[model samples]
Target: MSKVVLITGGSSGIGKSIGEFLTEKGFKVYGTSRSPERYTSSKFPILKLDVKVVSTISDCVQSLLEQEDRIDVLINNAGVGITGPLEEIPLEEMKSHFDTNFFGPLEVIKAVLPQMRKQHSGLIINVTSIAGYMGLPYRGIYSASKGALELVTEAYRMELKSFNIQMTNVAPGDFATNIASGRFHAPVNENSPYKTAYGNTLKLMDSHVDSGKDPKIMAEAIFKIISTKNPNVHYKVGEFMQKFSVALKRILPDKMYEKLLLNHYKL
Candidate 1:
């Protein structure tokens, strides 16, 4: 029997690209969307799932396991973005952001871990972002959420090693996707101190994503990662500069890195 792969947020964007790519490679692929009816794929079946809802996550995994017997790979690619000034952003909005981006993936991991542990072998790939490594102007909450997920991926690697279950955090810098359009923007205070700066930086961030690399590149990278017997704990995907900037941040002085981010976003 072919190895089974389950991907969340597979209705479109990077998740859909990866699901289709893996299916073409002969894996039994299952993809999930809030409304499966909106996405039709003959090669891989779509299941209804909303990462924010624990019941939907449990039901989705249960249904998949009943038919496939095992899930060889679980990709936590379902997430949402929130942007605005942190100080002015409402607490509820931040909670909602974390619900989808951080807790959502955590809940899915919980739902699938039992099956993976039972098999004594499986891979969990959490799709993080380059933003996870640093807090960006006007996108601090989104950064914080991804950053939290990245930390969990590290801890999981150590904890699951004894069980022979593997985990990887795939951090993509930017990809051409509808994420920008779908992102939730907190209500901005007109008189906030950083209002003008926030708006300009937000615009720059959107443009950056608009010109990001194709999602196919990320899909190809993920496929290669899956084929490897022992992949790295983390993989960074993006253009030369985007990936390089991550490296630079590590080596640069704190103030220098902050300046680079400010200049990049025109803040």
Candidate 2:
């Protein structure tokens, strides 16, 4: 029997790519999208779900349950990016990012965990980013959200290990996705604060994203990962990110590593 996988943020980009990829392999995929019409042509089941809104989670899960009776894999891939000076970004925007990127996944997990525990088997793959491991200028909010999810995923895996629930943290390096070009007017600012200081760093992060690796590479990596019975606690895709973090941790001194990061962003 083919396995049933539920994915959040499956409307487009990496999330949509993974959903289609898994569907081709014959898995029954239930994918959540804010705009269900956008994915009317997708291979898997498309359901309307806005990750930022907590109330929508259970309804979506219930819809999936009616179809498959159980969820074998739950992948949290929904997230948003707000790039700019952290100080300039409003507190409400910061909270919005956390609510969507972190708490959204937590809610989904809480809904599905009981079913997995009853089945005595399941896999949870979180689509985090390299920013989770290392702080980045201009992307502070995004990085912080991913980092918190990483920690939560760690505890979730530890506690669920006895139930045979496997967890994998997928940290993709810069990937060629439409995220950098996505919608959003510049957030309204109460006042122009730290304008000059944050300009260069924000430009640097945007440039790095422009030169990111292909998203398909990361999608293929995900396919290989879940196919294995014993998956690693964390998997870093893309050479640019894998080498960057590993080298920083092993070769450079603490101060030197910090200096390199700052230099990378021309800060």
In the order shown, the candidates' Cα RMSDs to the true structure are: 1.2, 2.3
CA shift at 266, candidate 1, in angstroms? 1.8
The TM-score obtained by model 2 is 0.91
The C-alpha TM-scores of every prediction are 0.97, 0.91
lDDT values of the candidates? 0.90, 0.80
Model 1: CA > 4 A from native? 41-43
Question: Which number leads on TM-score?
Answer: 1
> How far in Å is the alpha carbon of 198 misplaced in model 2?
3.1
lDDT tens digits, residue span 35-58, model 2: 898767887778988877767888
For model 1, which pairs clash? none
Q: After TM-score superposition, what is the CA distance of residue 248 in candidate 2 from its true location, in Å?
A: 1.4
- Give the Cα error of residue 217 in candidate 2, in Å: 1.3
Candidate 1 per-residue C-alpha lDDT over 1-267 given as tens digits, one digit per residue, 9 for 90 to 100: 688999999878999899889988898989999999876644589998999999999999999999988999999999888889888888998998899999999999999999999999999999999989988888899999999999999998999999989999999988899999899886556878987888887788789889988999989999999999998988999988888888898999999999998888877
User: Could you tell me the C-alpha RMSD of candidate 2 in Å?
Assistant: 2.3
